[model samples]
Target: MNRTPEPELMQIPSQVRAYADADFSRSDSMVVKSLEKFLKKAGRTLNKNDLIFDMACGPGNIAERIAKNWPFVNVVGIDGSKEMLNEAENRLSLNLTKNLSYELIDINSIASGEIHFPFKADLLVSNSALHHFHDPYCFWGALKKLGKTKCIHIHRDLIRPASDEKAFELKEKHLSNSPEILKKDFYASLKASFTVDEVSQQLVDAGLSQLEVFQVDELYFEIIGCI
Candidate 1:
């Protein structure tokens, strides 16, 4: 498998990040709803005792939701941006329970052994954040380390194509019916997203043969693994 050079660190603009934080906080009816349904269907039990890490966790939206749904599950939301982390901390506080927290950490650094969290997670999850990684391989390596029992990685991002026209078509059709928020998200995601073949090849290169990759929707991908 040929590895692509890691992309540069893609910083989320403050305005965009703020918009995302607010959108996630208020709009729980779409992907978040689907996510809960999916988790239930998968029979994932989040108990208070289990330690779960939300990698690239933005404003702790997913983390808070998970914590609320499974009051017993301990959740730690990790992000690289201090601003996002601060917002996440504030959000976590408002929805405070005993089992949730937030931390600021760079995903790539963690993957390269420059930084370490004290605990190994029972489950490592992220939403729409994987595409932001400057080094996707490092992200995968970190996931490999954290995914001890079950890995339920749900990413609702854009899907790129191997070729130019396919990519354009995907964007055109996908954006046509989407809401404004989704439109912005879709384009950004498309620019940042990887093709299924690309991600599959990466898994193979990473020696992660046990990983299962699925196209959940034209705009979403689900990657699952069992340690």
Candidate 2:
């Protein structure tokens, strides 16, 4: 099936609200678990000065988890959508999330030299970020600018199904209970996603072949490595 591109930012009020209200704890937890497992294997310990960026972070779900998991390290959730970030901030308490913050940034701007974030990332993580970019190179090019030398990465995204029938089956199988708007968006995202082979080729094209791409399950794929 040919890929269908969705808007990069979740700016619609109803759409953003639906996404923020949806329960993603199950899949979201998987991202944290994978990152922790990866770090343990590498035997790398995070410190106060370490900077962790959650790229294209929507509702800050994964970013919050990482910040709380490692309270000493600074965590910033960067997203292009104000509505999404607002929802993310609503869930954040200054008292509870002292080490956590949000940045309004269009990731593609970094690649174009329009936005220059002063600090480089020690660890950059993104969940459901890659498929949003119409041009995949925009995603990788911006990442290269943001990450420090040897920065650790863990990015997870839905894998495009082989056909529209397969995509619908996966959507209903996974999110049958979700709201109509949420379900619609989820279906669009699944259609917009890339396969493991395509993502692997993208990594090579981006000069990031050091990263490893593998299917995590039927619905998603993970990219992990140091760059």
Number of the top-ranking candidate, with TM-score as the measure: 2
Which ten residues in a row are the worst by lDDT in model 1?
1-10
For model 1, the superposed segments whose C-alpha errors exceed 4 Å read 1-13, 21-44, 149-156, 161-185
**Model 2 lDDT tens row, 1-227:** 99999999889999999999899998899999999899899898889999999999998999999998999999999999999998889889644699999999999999888999898999999999999999999999999999999899999999999999999998899999999999899999999999999999999999999999999999899999898
Task: Report how far off residue 224 is in candidate 2 (Å).
Answer: 0.5
Clashing pairs in 2: none
- Candidate 2 vs. truth: CA RMSD? 0.9
Q: Relative to the unseen true structure, what is the C-alpha lDDT of residue 119 in candidate 2, on a scale of 0 to 100?
A: 88
Can you give the TM-score per candidate against the true fold? 0.77, 0.98
Q: How many backbone clashes does candidate 2 have?
A: 0
Local distance difference test scores for all models: 0.66, 0.94
Q: List clashing residue pairs in candidate 1.
A: 47-72, 47-73, 48-72, 48-73
Task: Estimate, for each residue in 69-129, the C-alpha lDDT of model 1 and write its tens digit.
Answer: 6677788888887767777777666756678888778888778888876788877777776
